[model samples]
Target: MIRVRVVTSRRLHVASLSTCTTPDSLLAYGSRILHCPDPHKKVALTFECQNRWKSEALPVYTGSLWGSDEAPGLPARGPRPELLAPKKMPSMKQLQTQASIPVIMLHALAHIELGAIDNYWDTLVRFDPVKFQLPRDFYDDFLTVAGDEARHFQMVDNRLRELGSEYGALPATRALLEHAANTAADLAARIAIVPLVQEARGLDSGDRLVHRMKSMGDKESAKVVEQIVWEERNHVRCGMKWFQHLAKVQKREQDQVAYFQELVLQFFPDGLPGPFDVEARQEANMGTEWYESLESKVAHPSGVKLEKRGDTQSASVAAFAASKKKVILAGSVWPERTSSAAGVRSADIIQVLQERGYQVLCVSPSRLNDHTSKLQEEQGVRCIQADANTDIFQKLLLETMPQLVVFDRFIAEEMYGWQAKKYSPEALRVLDLQDVHFIRRAREFAVKKQGLNFKETLDGEQLDIDPVEKIAIRELASIHRSDLTLYVSDFERDLLVSRFQVPDMNLHRCDFFYPAIDVSKLNSFNDRRHIAFIGSFKHSPNVDAVEWAKKHIMPVYRNLGGDAEVHIYGSYGETKRFVKLNDPKQGFFMKGFAPDAHETLSQYRLSIAPLRFGAGIKGKIADSWFVGTPCVSTSIGAEGMSLDGLQWGGTIADTPDTFASEMLHLYNDEARWDVAHQAGVAACSARYDASRNGDSLMERLERTMVEKRELREKNWMGRILWSENYRATEYMSRYIHAKNDGVNNGVK
Candidate 1:
């Protein structure tokens, strides 16, 4: 025989606090606890709040269950403990001294416990569960946590008094609250920093303190620390549970781990130290994924782990201070991922730099969203709007003092490179020549000059283009000027070294990284429906590919396949040229913008990239293979993106008729399609695995940083080019800026 107690506004257990003291709203109860300065009274209030919530069910507000009247302010206290800012806090490096260690340790525990009490209650009031669409259980869990923290505080304070000291006997630091204040506007961030990081870290602290006490022949004190650690383990579990709930509610379920790691970096760039108690943390549902990435970060520099959490302030500050290596990624306004592969390429570069243990700041002159903003919100990539010609950029340079400055393209270097060199002279200037603009322009010129349809392949294998175009001359000089140049293609890396006489040591082949996507998991050949081509129309290579496809490949493909349609997917499709080509009746459909390219490609049987000439890795072919939908591309289109020996996961044919023929054969045969799909997966694993590329890039960047001065010394031509060209670029930019300023000021 069992009885159930339903929670309601009336009463569950029929025991209640004074009606006036215990408010019906959880929010009002929160205000009282936060404002209460008397530590003992605060503890009393927490126990009362907990009992009242469990017995007389407080109305968890749908909309301030107090009915839209203003919520009450926190009751003002006469005085607060002498709160020390993070910087003013004293270091506790010396763990042992002539003074009683128990009191010192107990005081630290009391401060942490008091903070924990506030952390839970403040979360309840500020981030309304109803407003965030959170479950009512959220308030219940936090109330329980608040009760535990209040009890922990009492226990620690009692221990302190027994040792002839009371709580607030010494100055204390509120770094937790300060860091929490930084994320006051963001609830998810508050949760990440407060409980997931700060409180969970307390578990580590408790373990050390327990060991310390037992070592000092204070078994009784060790028991008290042990009790706190046990309760804290549960408190951390509550945080992890609610955090997962919040992530699902906020639609960050898939990105929870990555976003959690990012927030940790954003709030505390210096890695959080740990000889993390794995058993305790795992019991709390806080896995190694959350803290291990960070553990090897600050204190564990060069892969050696820090064994101790010396004291509260030093461990916290050492882990919180901005001592980590830093890098600045400057390019277009921001990463416009949908606009071109250039955007994707730059985003990947930032990922590798971050993996290298550098805190990245992405800066651009243009305002946000003109190009796509890469949700600097989650990735912890700080995006700042500062132009090259201004004092803002100069100030930023001095403040960041970045160890590495990667100009996204030669053009970005051409824009901000001179300014970076002037200011952060010691910084390694890596030129990410995403593609050699000169080689691309040269191919485009040769095609146009030969009077061929833009997609017609060059007759001979040997490449020919004018070496004297302004873009070529400018790009070549830009290449030599940087410390190390990053190339995406083997052919291009070799081309600069052999043909252009740039040193091979000064160049590196860094390609796009892809985590291997499982082909078996993707839609099978029979499940997929149509033939498609996807690209951003802003790029001429894509526009040329489309024009060539419509004119040559699609006609042959449609003629043979009695029932097949070519769906064109891309950005900038509203251009009248593409708009006029939208003929659905003839099986050529135009999809303006596909928000998810992988999803779009999965619905297609095969993709056609009829690019006659282009530089760098072809993203469309990559996308096709990424989704296990085989692609048909020309040799030029398939350049540098080989899975095995010259294999691009599908077929490579130079001629239009043959390109169409190869795609149809692969589409018709399931066995052939399966092989192609596996090849693509293998290619992605080999070529674009982020772990491989990111680690390699970090190592390369570090080596280049060490060799920067010597490398620059070895290149007399590079020095001459930088001295002459970059300075001239500097003057020209300043002149333009002044002219624009004068025009705005009505000076002319």
Candidate 2:
């Protein structure tokens, strides 16, 4: 087993030192620097050690490999140079706007390099060759990387001092160390993620960062980083070389892009998030094809689909067919009920598409025995059952030959989006995010854990990770893969762009499309009584809201001389868990599942939705407006409605007492109620007129279809995913289908 030895100043000689062989003294000086908490002293000692290592007079010592020695693990976090959470760091844009953004940036980079030195050194010592028997040159290469990292640290640290700041002056995140910690047990993963993935990112960003510094008139700093950038290419080269070496030793295929992608997927939840630096990666011998594949996995929300351009006749036929303006709308299920928001939107969309002379086919992945025919008859739109797992689905696409394909939700896009790309390559794929599922799940998690009264939902505190990492990965993939995603709420649209880092051009917000109502037909606010809340209680937030209303709003209502009963109407109100919340004497009655939502709701003077956490527009508020029923709700409930208190027939109240007061006031005051009701009617007419919104959506779709290639070029990430990453998902889906069919056949 190859080992790194410590060269002593006394003899100018290299002494035998096994990194893991000594329990207490693993090169006394090197180990001490590793344990040092101060960043400045740590770097200084590391340099001193490197200087001794380079001495020509240093003699080599060969000794028997010890079996009983323990490996030295990662050092403890240092006290100096405070480690802050990722949120504490200012955004790159924010830093650029500051007077000393360059200095702060340099300091942060120095801290990262310092961490890198430790990481390399730790890996060298901790991963015992006796146990794993890695080649001698492996240690030699890493030792060189460690030494180079120390020099890189010194360059930036010195630059920081010249700028009147030191390495410990600013707070840094533990991002560099966290990655190291994640791959501690696996050597190949360490090589793939750290050098190939993480370091490769640096290669991509280096030129831009250097140019930015030069633009800022920091020539010296720019030169320093430029040098580091060039040198870092070698580090990436080392990582790539070693990774290939290890892969070959393990009998893996040479230069395999799929193997690299597999490692990334195994390590990262979201495959390589990127705006890659292609040139530097090529210099490091990571071919453009390899980087593209990695980028496709990480950046693509849906797997990329390669266009099969083999049949020129089919292409000609597709082009000719496209002139007819055919569209195929795919959904997870057929939306049921005219009163349903999704159903209403779906119906209006079909009407508008047809009016525009586009042939539209609404398809669902329901089994043949499902109610597809009944739904088609009721909706007056041709609905088809296209089983996504079968070749029949592909046939359906080829036959309809849609110019535009609408993915009803992210899930639909995941299931059938690749098929659209396969059978209809020219089609413009759009994902209508029926409210981002992950965001909804995240808010639901916060509500469950922190209780209904948690102020984070109302105060606009960044709701971080109520949804687990897995859900986020899936949703992001769906968004990235689709050409464009339709958002119902501007707030959610902004969240996707700002927090989730989705490119803005990929999102389309059309809140007004979901709440179309005939203002002339709405009942006047007269002779109405009782407070009402309505939702499908199968939704967790709806259940939470109802429970909150009973506990928080009901007592306040009764105390304020509000004698009206509070009716909770939903499908699951009479279910086992909810039956207990019903108490007619206390003026809270659970009216389970109204056959006609508008008919039951129109009798009420006011509506209430104390939604704590959820995403997209609230359907209840829209329903209230359509029925001429004013609403009092929490800010969360009012989201995506574009409502401002009385401006849209709703009052937003977060507190329990305030919610009860708003409900009572709207129920009693005819003048205020009239204002809210009229505003709601105006909103419905202006913003949610089906014809108007439908026309706008149709226009956008037509424009997108026309500029499909241009749009694809602009969304290169999606293009890459569709072309490269999508094959894995396609084959996997096919494999699953085959397996299921075989099982079914055996059973028969």
Candidate 3:
């Protein structure tokens, strides 16, 4: 036989079942039986049966007939009336009648209480109130509500336990709380509808629970329901007071009831209509007139409308016509003969412009054919392919008529610089000084010769310095011809202004804009091991850095008996010499061409860029810092970083011995390693945040545009002189264009 009992504790209700069976079996049966549609406070039953004696049996009877012994032949009858009535059942109404109203009311209180708790935590952590005008009183009220809600959850939770079930044992609803969360942006609406409206409904529902529980003879549970009713009246009053205060302060002369009704219509159109608890509301301080006015309004919530605007056609046209500015970007010698650094710079500038809602066009040698056309389709960028050295390129420029033309080095002086002026005179021309190419070449030659004699490298060269100088003259000539020039570093800018005698008006220092990749994807420094050397392997300096590390640094790690691997990676093939230098036996691994440098670098314990000599900023070092991989580099390699007093992430060790020692120390000492890694990450984030550097670039672009317009107005005389000087240059280009066109026609 099985029996069930419903219990209440701390105003919560639950049902417990007991049977003469194993605990596990009993629990399983209890779970199923409790889930039945019928609700009863308790049910008990007792079974009785007769024992066999003689062939002739006696009839069983109750009340009047005690022990009946009719003669031995008399027939037997079945059990009595008490046994027949053992299967006592209650109707659905009776089952519902058994539940305590106060317990049900407390459950409703938990709904709003939990919403307040969730909102309070979310507001404090997620949305900083300092950023908004959230009043102190608002926070105070929220805190007060949160405390009451805690009490409510505890009260309900306790009652559920007393009833032999836990809070999660029964199905629960968060419909009200979810609504509150969804409508969080507007606080007053939340208070009005959730606490006042939804909760007022709970107050009425509580009365019903108490009535049913009392009729079922569960007087204890009934008492708990009554307690919740008393406290909730005050809670609803708080909501009422705040709602009226907001209405008065905002000068909402529309009757308070009508205003609340309008808010409900606007914010919660799907809400239920109500014959509200007028007495309870009045006690909570809501006026009868306001309540009546609220009941009159009926509407559904509508979706909010937002506006959209079209392309900024006007700004684009204005920016282009403002003035003609000149910019020169130098340094171009690389394996492809098209500067990779310049490509990075162009991409960065284009990205920044796009972010600021500007229309931009990209021109690259790679874009000359279907490849460029396809790129345009995929990237949504307008790209054109024109040779820097051809007269046809100028014709293309005249057709496109761009406002700004950026020249990265004097790749083709006769083609791009002179012809741009001849074709698009109004376009602002800019030059990017990637580095002092001449000085870089001179230094490279001197280092190769194993001597400090710089003059030897320039003696026989007609360009007057070295290999890089020949390029620099053409580069400088292009700068002189342009309106403005951009230098990546202060050192490079100063070198042109002070050493090369480039005029101040033609120069502007624009630092390199680091490429924006997903920084969050990088794992923290703790996950990495192995020292890495990253750079374009084709570059002489990077090649030198790698070779120096393999020969000088690896032996130290081997001697120290540490398990550190040296990984050399960049964009180049492993030549015979490189292969011989990177032997697996020596723990050297050559990983070729990392398309995503930061992603690859992030897996390394430390980065090494022991560049013997180089010009301009090293992208590899910047990439290392970006990934929080501390680097060890020479002073030349670390130049222009402006990382003042910050531990070199590792060490600026120029000598082989010092480099080896520093590398070992950083590898073995965890504390020093952590500090360096943190510093590197900080440096990259602070120095290269788009919000900081990008703003300056935009401001400079605007200023340059204005200044160029002024210059054009003041230098109408210079323009005429320049036109006369460019006439000869224009004739030569036209002659070349005609010759090329004739050849193509003849071939056809």
TM-score per candidate: 0.55, 0.55, 0.50
- Per-residue alpha-carbon lDDT of model 3 for 274-355, expressed as tens digits? 4344435544555334433233213223442222112442242344334243222211211121224545655566566667
Expressed as tens digits, the lDDT of each residue in 1-748 for candidate 1 is 2223334552222212232455556765666666666777878988887887888787664232322111123322224556678688656644234237777777877888887787777777766445468777888888888888888888778777777878887667767555535766667787888888887877766656776798788876776777677666777888787777778888998988887878788877755754455536755767545665554312123434333223642342233236469887887447655656667777777777666676877776544442323445556676666655445566667766788888877767876888888889999999988888767766776676575553443322345655426567677888888898899888777777777888888888888777767655899878988788999775667888888788887788778773578899987565445778888777888887799888889898888888876788888887777788788888778877864473558888888778878877888888998888778767877787888888888889899888888888998878887775546667766665564444334454
Q: Which parts of model 1 have CA positions greater than 4 angstroms off?
A: 1-323, 370-374, 452-462, 643-646, 734-748
Ordering by TM-score = 2, 1, 3
* Ranked candidates (lDDT, high to low): 1, 2, 3
How many times do residue backbones clash in model 3? 27
Residue 567, candidate 3: C-alpha displacement in angstroms: 0.6
lDDT of 3 at 179: 56
Which 10 residues in a row give candidate 2 its minimum summed lDDT? 59-68
List candidate 3 segments past 4 Å from native: 1-342, 364-374, 388-392, 412-414, 450-468, 514-525, 560-562, 644-647, 709-735, 741-748
Tell me the lDDT of model 1 at 566: 82
